[model samples]
Target chain A: MDATVTLKDVAARAGVSVGTASRVLSGHSATSPAARERVRAAATELGYRVNARAQALRSARSHAVGLLVSDVRNPFFADIAHGAEQTALASSYVTLLANANEDTAQQDTYLDVFLTQRVDGIIIAPQGEGRGNLRALEEARVPLVFVDRVVDGFDVPSVTADNAQGVELAVAHLAEQGHTRIGYIGGPPSVSTGRARLSAFLEAVARHHLDDDPALITAGDFRRASGGTAAAKLLAHHRPPTALLAADSLMAVGALAEVRQRGLRIGEDLALVAFDDIEWFGELDPPLTVVAHDARALGATAMRLLLDVIDGGTAESVVLPMRLIPRRSSAARPHTAASHPSV
Target chain B: MDATVTLKDVAARAGVSVGTASRVLSGHSATSPAARERVRAAATELGYRVNARAQALRSARSHAVGLLVSDVRNPFFADIAHGAEQTALASSYVTLLANANEDTAQQDTYLDVFLTQRVDGIIIAPQGEGRGNLRALEEARVPLVFVDRVVDGFDVPSVTADNAQGVELAVAHLAEQGHTRIGYIGGPPSVSTGRARLSAFLEAVARHHLDDDPALITAGDFRRASGGTAAAKLLAHHRPPTALLAADSLMAVGALAEVRQRGLRIGEDLALVAFDDIEWFGELDPPLTVVAHDARALGATAMRLLLDVIDGGTAESVVLPMRLIPRRSSAARPHTAASHPSV
Candidate 1:
């Protein structure tokens, strides 16, 4: 029972040249129906699996896509990866993922490897502020798309959430609840998403006619520990905020722990809203109010855009929509009712 | 500016033959100190960024390692990938990770891609059923090490958690808590880790002189939804188990949600313990008692073993240690007077 089947056997059974069989099996549309059907039947009969490695070397297309993320442990990225996987699977392509851990050098290394492997395209959630090697990838005519984050001046294809609008929704939600003194716990200001969301928060505060409290804003690196640190700093302010807006879910989790640690009731004592509705958010004790970006949608859209780019479509960018999921965390502000004249 | 630099330029600047420069740059110790010094100086002066891809193609060894995970979204796999990357970095070997998504076909696709990319070695967590096209990969003489799970008959180098021991720890801990009848919810019996853990759970019950209650055992596909289903069945039993042991973290999360949804108090009404100490486990309300397998350690050890295999070591398996992390979830049992004191 040697069971090792090759494309040659498939070609022989199909009565077509090996090249035609290869094309049919690779899902290339150029193959005629008669030839494709023959190849398909032959493949089934022989139990012949396409030799993807040989095909990659011959065609210089790996039939694999590269997915680069800032952090793999974050459920946000995980959701994106899952979405990308589903899309890739549908198209008969596999995804190779790399977690750059926000390291610029690692990103470069992954890009080089992807190039060497000749992947069809790359979808990356870049660690903001590095475009040197990314530009090199573009120069090499590699199909690359940015996901979740965008580069400063690169005219590359991308699919990202409406971070500013999402932040605006969170801010408006808080304002409607009478949260005047609101705190902003954002990711590192170096990242584009963080900067955009923070700016939106300030603009929303002004638009809602609320006083800006500079002391209540603290920055984090989008990790739980950073969230805890930011929350602690904001809470210790001379005039602490009545509500908090976390830039991401991990930060929100950290903030929740911080609030609990201090014996503060989530909805009663302090209101909170966050971004990126990661899985298990709904399962939390007091479900969090969040400006939710569909991570899977972002990944799927980025993959589609990259595939188009790989097929010679004009490069473009996409901004995905966001939704505000209201939960128990944000409620009517307790302090405002006593002071307002409408009461 | 045409920024492409080649080995010839460095050799010319160093006033040495191309062979001498190539050997020196490649870190071949056979080269004399004078030649190496000249090559180093020339490289530094020329700012030569070696085209590692070209070098790899010529020498047939990429200073790269391929890592294949079951799913990138699984925090357990992500941690393992992180560990592998950290270790690969220390050795100056870049790590390329692929998310197989537990699909045999997809896993086969990645194995082919990895082979074509010519990674020096690979660390794979197989999809856990069937021999797959892995036999072809083995025939290619690629250096590979299995992580987390391995095929029953394949004598591949591997590094995995002590699943049996982990289950024993959980069962023993619960048993000591005065819980008699305990339910075991596990993944598909086809998976090595799942079957091993489930068998160990039953064995531990027998060893501890506890009743072998057939109604207390159920299996799922190792999904949260399946865990919820399994939990429902167990809780609905006439004499519900005093404690529950889940095969993995996601299942535990599912069981926890189900228990809470049913208005049963965890750590009191129904004690719960699970495998895989995922990120949110500690942050979970009432926390989670778990048989903690260091996924990071598993990846690092697997990669280390892969490097060894690449360097001519025999294919052997290493079982990493597992421990129990006590949290509030399984602190006490409600039915303290039950005769099955061994939970």
Candidate 2:
């Protein structure tokens, strides 16, 4: 039997027109019972399976969605991809996952590929403000959903974490621990999470009456190397912070390396807190303090939103709440017990 | 301008046939220079973009490859995916990654989907021994390459780590450290890595004149929770081993948790070693000793082999070498120094 048997072959064998055969094979109610029966028999006899590309060309529905994450190696994004892919699979939709590698140019390249692929929809953890293929996707009127981060000027439904609340929780805990000078390592300002979290950190710092020194703030590309660079800059400041907070898990790992290289001990000499909570964070020697949010839920929710949009239904944006989990990394300051009686 | 402009529309505007327009647009050398120029002008004027699905149908090539990993959330597989996707992109091909979630059924489902999507080739970290869609894919003559694991009786080219060498290295290291009774936490026997590593462990132990107690070996399903379960079983043995070795990173993590829960200090009371070296392994309190293999290189190599097969070239199987990195976790046995006087 020929493996590449087409619909035309089935139609010919069924003694029916290609249109009637297609309708019957696609389970369209418009087909007569007799025509459907003949087409079914012919298809079964010929061992003909529907060609997904041809079907997609005809119906304009590929039954596939593109999921573009900032970085695939990042555990947070990996969890998200797992969640989204599983959710999409449950709906009989395949997810084509792409990694932007935290580069805006790479993100744009993937967005263009996704557009060309003509996926039913797209869910993206965007890298930059609205530019390049991001604008093209919007102009093409593709059903789009943002996960974790969003582009500016795009009115797209998104699933994001509560950056302000997470920052507040971490800052408040540090304040309670009598850490008056805390360094901040954040993501690049081009990204929504970076902007939102940095602003939230500033707000939290002001609310806690802590040192609001501009020199205490630094930014990375939300990657490990950048985190180490940011940490180095903050630690070298003339009035260095006693504590440090990284906006993401990779950066936190990088910051930890820098702190260790400087002969400073986490949870003892300097306090540290990270935004995302990875599985192994708790297994670290002194463990780690983290602002926790569900990365899997973020991906799942973004997929759900994309599915809804694909079905021609509008979806509302979702902002998930965050909480702080204090571990040994942010243990209370021993020296502060004398100066700050509250400690 | 209409977004769905067809080649026929461009052909009509160019005063040429649809076939001429298609050949010109697809960069076929058979097209006349005049027709090509006219079709290009018409296509540009009408803002006509070739639909990827339609092109795939016409060419029988999707210019996409499906990569099905055993587990997406596993850092090892995630790194592999990143490498494969990046390599595929460099060749102007997109990689559609799917997570098998460590289940055979899920692997079959994704394989079938990849077939339906008419991908040019596929790379998989297979779960079971030559069953389900694996057979179907083989019969269909799809360009296939195996990464990390290969099924029995399959002639498929694979890029796999030298499991025997890795296991031998770990076993010898433990033996040299004065651990005669080493408990092994291995992957399920059904998997290639699991079977190969276990057999290698047995052979190494017998060669070194160490204890070959069957009770010292336990198997997990190459997952975290399974590792913990296996560890629990090993630790509960009446004559428990002084040191433990996990076959994979996730299992190692699980074993670590189990040891911690029992208040057994790693490196001091119980030595530990893992097969794969994750990035943060060195950052652990006592750090982790691991048999390290380049997961990214494995993925990249698999993809290159697949592309070779797709281009009608026979490719050779690649066996990547592994090395052991000794850390505090697998430090020398303290009491053995006095008793054996070999330190």
Candidate 3:
């Protein structure tokens, strides 16, 4: 669907007058609740794209895009920001990055800042429910594209990694390596990627006929320290998993330290794999095996999507593919074939 | 010094009227060159701190600070940004981060954005000469602080690593290993840290009476790929050095790959020490010895200093100390005493 769909099309589909449809789209309180709902549903069904340039023609163009990241400390997000900013700069636009620091309130604050700064468009690694400033952005008709995660029921385009595929790849690789009981350290369920990957892990393990013990699973807040904490808990179990899968790179780093502290060698005593790939990962003692996601490309693609929206073009959401890169971290031989009870 | 020094005091010291002093300080084009010179010199001498809060009281507070970093992809700056943002958030201020990508033109673009955004203040890890936006920031009386790198002749508060001390520790440790022919991969001389570290390296080599050949020193852009290029040039020499020192962690990571590609064993074939200490360094095969600088503390300190200035509090610039962390990377056995040109 292109930007050819207009308010008249939405009005016709909603069975409302063009004036009422325009009023509802403009967020006018005079509209009835039923009419508002119909107009919104009709707009979504018709794939009616907002003409951001037309909405913004009243003000001079700032040529600035606000990029709100979940966390600046996360190297994955940092790489994404680099890619997005470089792409924006190439198009003569500058990206002003704000770190939500993985907090909803902080995200709201930056959203307000972006609005007041009059940024031409915004690209966010969104957090929390689609309320408050996020809703405000849609109401204000600001051009936006979600980068990593997306909120439910939001009519926003996004460029995100295939989290389910990544989790399945990591799990199948460990199962093939004779690890029947694999410890899974996942992210908080509140985040979309977190929930998707965790669900994928459970499904993949069942497909491989591996242990479904509750003790094998743990969740972290997608940060480094949480990974360490989760690893510690898993290792202290009576029957620890022979292999470990961390949902992200930061958590994996934390897990590596915890494993080393317990005098267990990675790739040997405990096979390990993480979700994201960073350049320095290969420098690790036994290079880290990872489910590789192109974070830079994700950022670049998101910017392109946002620009298309800003230029009155409609674009589809992108789900980038992922692949597994095996290194020494998960390449060590198991003691015997008996470790794989399912096979 | 304190913001107590007023226009009257400056004018009196410079033998000019209060109106003339105000014009010069306000960057009024009507001011004479001599008057601007006298006013600036007098202000510097009196340590006339800008009262950004007072100047900004006329405009509604944005409560947002701009933090311009050299490179977001560099983990060092990433850590610094995290620390600064967390601290800023604690103060009920949000940080807007812009990546210069190690380019001066990019730096200018972001500076303009910050200015137009009406940020309460700015903290920059600066590059290029002390001109353009760097000068505009000073003349505009915007509260500013330098982190990691400082531009010369800018009387801005800064939080920077002790380059001399860091270089001394890394060089002395390597020298004690009886490896006199050490290769140094430094940063571009245009950068402050780069120049300081290179000068320190040259002096230390002279002090230790080691190989002072110009070929022993090479320059990179403080990025990963440049480090690889520099390492390739160094290793392809008529006789490669037994020890190598990369000025920054990114460059060091690149050197690691290059050394490995050349089939050189890091700990056994050549001793290596990097300047910045990152968490993953210890996870490298044989581990890495480093000159440790707390990047988080550097960032946190710079933010605190910037906040103090915004609050009209006088504070001294900080020169943080550095330490040496010895690991297997630099614990290799020397082939013979003949490796020491002086001894």
Instruction: Please report the candidate that would top DockQ against the real structure.
Output: 3
**What tens digits encode model 2's per-residue C-alpha lDDT throughout A2-65?**
6789878899999987756876776655568899999999999999988877566547677779
What is candidate 3's lDDT per residue for A81-183, written digit by digit as tens? Answer: 9999988887667999998888888899999989888898999999888889999998888999999899988999999999988988998898888888888
Off by over 4 Å in 3: A1-58, A336-343, B1-59, B336-343
Q: Rank the candidates by DockQ, best first.
A: 3, 2, 1
lDDT per residue, candidate 1, A1-343, as tens digits? 1258877788899998765677687777657899999999999988886566655543666668898888887889988988887887776667878888877888888888777767888998887576667888778767788899988877787889998789889988888887788888998877788888888888888899876978978899999888988888887776678888999999989998897787676776788899999777766757788899889898888887776665445557889889999988887485832233221
TM-scores, all candidates, are 0.82, 0.82, 0.83
Report model 3's interface C-alpha RMSD after superposition on the true interface residues.
1.1
Is 2 or 3 the stronger prediction by lDDT? 3
B116-160: candidate 2 lDDT, tens digit per residue: 667889999997887889998998889999999989998899999
Which regions in candidate 1 have their CA more than 4 angstroms from the true location?
A1-58, A331-343, B1-58, B314-316, B336-343
DockQ for every model, please: 0.43, 0.50, 0.60
Candidate 3, residues B151-243, lDDT tens digits: the string is: 999988999999999999988998898988899999998899999999999999998888998898999999999989998898887777888
**Model 1, B230-309: lDDT tens per residue?**
99888888777888899988888888889889877777677899999987777776688898988988888887787666
- Candidate 1 docks with a DockQ of 0.43
| TM-score of model number 3 | 0.83
